[model samples]
Target: MAEEKDAAEALVTDLQKKITDAFDVFDHESNKTVDVREIGTIIRSLGCCPTEGELHEMLAEMEEEEPTGYIRFDKFLPTMTKVLLERRYRPISDDIILRAFEVLDENKKGYLTRDELVKYMTEEGEPFTQEEMEEMISAAVDPDKNIVPYKDYAAMMVIDD
Candidate 1:
């Protein structure tokens, strides 16, 4: 158990050093941090391709101590660790589907009624046709409960990429 604990600590320390070194290359201004706008560059430097929306979502996940939208090495470490882990384990579409479910499940009931799903699919941005909406609900909705749990929704939308 002690050996396992020591190994984990060593791994974390090594990752932190690599991350801080990457940040240093871009922290040339001596601010000891990277602005949120440079997030894409930093992510790419770290060998990840993240959309602008994803970058904003990451910043949103940071704690209150990360004010000014500037990310220091300490703040960047945990956030990037989470982001990398999620990307490695989760399908990209899962995040999109989860966000959509959150928007439609306004009551925070953890499930969406058929009507809520329809409303979401028909909304202004990229409106889904009636047929597509019906297909989506039919594929994911629970017949007994008349709702789609977020897990079911994500499963229906996930593409093995």
Candidate 2:
């Protein structure tokens, strides 16, 4: 039990690091706060295409307040990793992935469109090629694509016990 607890804590720490790294990549100015656009860019980088609406939905999950429309660096980054890993690592369940998708989809829409993906990328100041955005959307939402909806996008993700 003690070992398991240690492992879990370690996983969380590693996940924090990943979030930090990802933020570094997305936060061009390095001031910390990630605006809606930055969030969109990061999603695109992760190989997922989100519609503008969907990008808003994902940001909603991390929003600490309203109007300001910003995700504080400390809260948003850590929570994203925690929520993402919890969903991915549960081998016995798709509940986590399903729920996350639901959240990102916002409007409870079943799928995200290319326009949304472009919106997110543009906001981040890092735009994706049409081909790249399409490929990412396919990975995340296309029933035919299987890159996501896995235990983790990759094994490098930190998992909780």
Q: For every model shown, what is its TM-score relative to the native structure?
A: 0.46, 0.48
**lDDT score at residue 134, model 1, on the 0-100 scale:** 78
Model 2 TM-score on a 0 to 1 scale: 0.48
Report the Cα RMSD per candidate. 11.3, 11.0
Clashing pairs in 2: 37-123, 37-124, 50-117, 51-116, 52-116
Evaluated at residue 136, the lDDT of candidate 2 is 64
What is the C-alpha local distance difference test score of each model?
0.71, 0.59
Model 1, global lDDT: 0.71
Cα lDDT tens digits for candidate 1, 22-132? 888888687777776676667666656555466567767653553786766667778877665455324466778788778767788999887777777787566766776
- Name the best candidate (by lDDT): 1
Q: How high is the lDDT of residue 75 in model 2?
A: 68
Residue-wise lDDT of candidate 2 within 48-119, one digit each (tens)? Answer: 444666566767777766647566777676657755565531332355545544565566555545555456
